[model samples]
Target chain A: MSAAAVLAVVVGAAAAKGELTGDPKAGEAIYARCFACHALAYNRTGPKHCGLLGRRAGSVAGFEYSAAMKRANWVWNRQTLDRFLADPLKAVPGTTMGYAGVKDRQERADLIAYIEQAGRSEVCRAR
Target chain B: MSSRIQSPDASLSLASDAPNLETRRSFLGKSGLVLSGAAVALLAGRDVLAKGNRPAGSDVNVLNSALGAELEAIAAYQVGAESGLLQKPVLNLAVTFQGHHKEHADVLTKTIIKLGGQPVSAKEKYTFPVETLKTQSDVLRFAAMLEKGAVSAYLGAVPVFENRDLAKAAASILGDEAMHWAILRNALGDAPVPAAFMS
Candidate 1:
């Protein structure tokens, strides 16, 4: 990730966590695994992660989501994302994302920070 | 991985003893007890009908059907645990998976009721091919086959939901069912993560 992106994520992380810390740079590295199926702007094997925060589950238009995901009523935020990042199946039950999940809490937090910051880009915003 | 070809169809049929599934030459069967794929057919019935295709039944039908399957799964686990054929570890795992099914059933029941639809009741008796449970391997294989069908059934129903929330609920169950399949398949000496796209 670029230095500016890292800075933004760090700042955002501080605000979201209220004195807790996360490394966006490290999170970006962690997010590499997710990149195989997801992109910032375009949907691939998984839905695009851009603007993922605050969006309701399975609400992405044009994406084929599972019935369970389409029915999920919760909004995506830092806390929800953290739990989901730690264990997708446990968090969402029937989500189709095939990855087992990032088990490390710190790693998950970092990934969330990176994703949140990435969502802010003009490219992501355009979606 | 074992030489057994993963037969998603015969295993998911749940109709008969599933002779094809029996003939697959699974390592589980070779190890000790043989598995009958008939149990998985439980989900193959109208329980999986998507709302889009048959709006008359809609979400209530799908939820009720799923509840029935979950109750069956719970009963299956109860039978397996009581049969004494499973190893202690395997038995514990079965119990845990059964709990997950119970959770699914609870959610389905509540959702159905919330929709002003009556929830389906658990069967007083289910006729699983219990005679096939000759060993721990048999129990795991049987459970694994059932989990695979659950994954397929939920995934198939996901796109059909008129209600997005129900769709999301199905997706959540699909993820757990997939996890259960992976673990059980691994125990049966098969490559757990065999595909990029889940069937």
Candidate 2:
């Protein structure tokens, strides 16, 4: 990330938590970091990607879901995902998604916006 | 990413592989998983959160739930594509699969509306473990995990739809999701079909 981009993200994070707004373009760039374990379609190190927003926490197929994930009544959306991403371990105690959650408020907002954008990108419509 | 009109068939059919498609053998490479020990703490025992704890309500409610999953899938695929981490063939595969989800969402949405229930809309946000996603392999593993979940989820769904037709449709989609799971497993060098039946 460039110094300017870093500065923008830091500045963005300075806002009050609940009032944060996302920049999809910035989020899209941040999302490149997510490619290590996820994809929009196929499964990778973790579960698949495209449906991360609309479904329940452990609803995707072909993977072992932790009891915590299966039990949570959480249906992912902006507010819900935002809360979860703010601290995944704190939110879902036994989730197998083994990473410290993204901490930057603006970065989180941007990442979420990019996630929403990813579903409709041309590459995702390849079929 | 633009909202352009599309014919139904366009999103559901298999197009040729992308320009960067690898050979058949090379195609066989993808994902894995690991749980964090801190998540366990050796003696932890409390559950958390409460939004998704919904049971299948009426037939309309059940279908709406399915619709929600389908919409999430559409979003996930496009987002993965934006990442630029996938190989050309993998990206092609993701697109084809994403198209399948769109088909699923379309049917679910129409069915919900026809049944006099408001179809659920896509959620405002979708989150993933971006910190773990530093490589293409990680992307594959994450995808595989989700595909496996989809396979299990549809198994539960197929039996729940009170409408026999809807049950059949869910079953069909379940098969498709299974295929995706198997292929990803194969790519990762694991047994594609690991069991006689879904657990």
State the lDDT of candidate 2 residue by residue for B1-199, as single tens digits: 2231212232322334532333431443332232222122111111111222222234555566566666766666666555678776777877767766776777777655655567777655555555566666776776777677666556655554445555666667778778987887776678988879763
Worst 10 residues of 1 chain B by lDDT: B1-10
**Candidate 1 residue-wise lDDT, B78-127, digit = tens:** 77666778775666677667766766777777666656567867644454
**What's the count of clashing pairs in each model shown?**
26, 54
* Highest-lDDT candidate: 1
- Each model's TM-score, in the order given? 0.45, 0.46
True contacts kept of 1: 0.00
lDDT of 1 by residue, A63-126 (tens): 7676777877879988888777666655776665533467677778888888988888776776
**CA shift of B140, model 1, Å:** 0.6
- The prediction achieving the highest DockQ against the true structure is 2
Residue B106: error of model 2 in Å?
A: 0.9
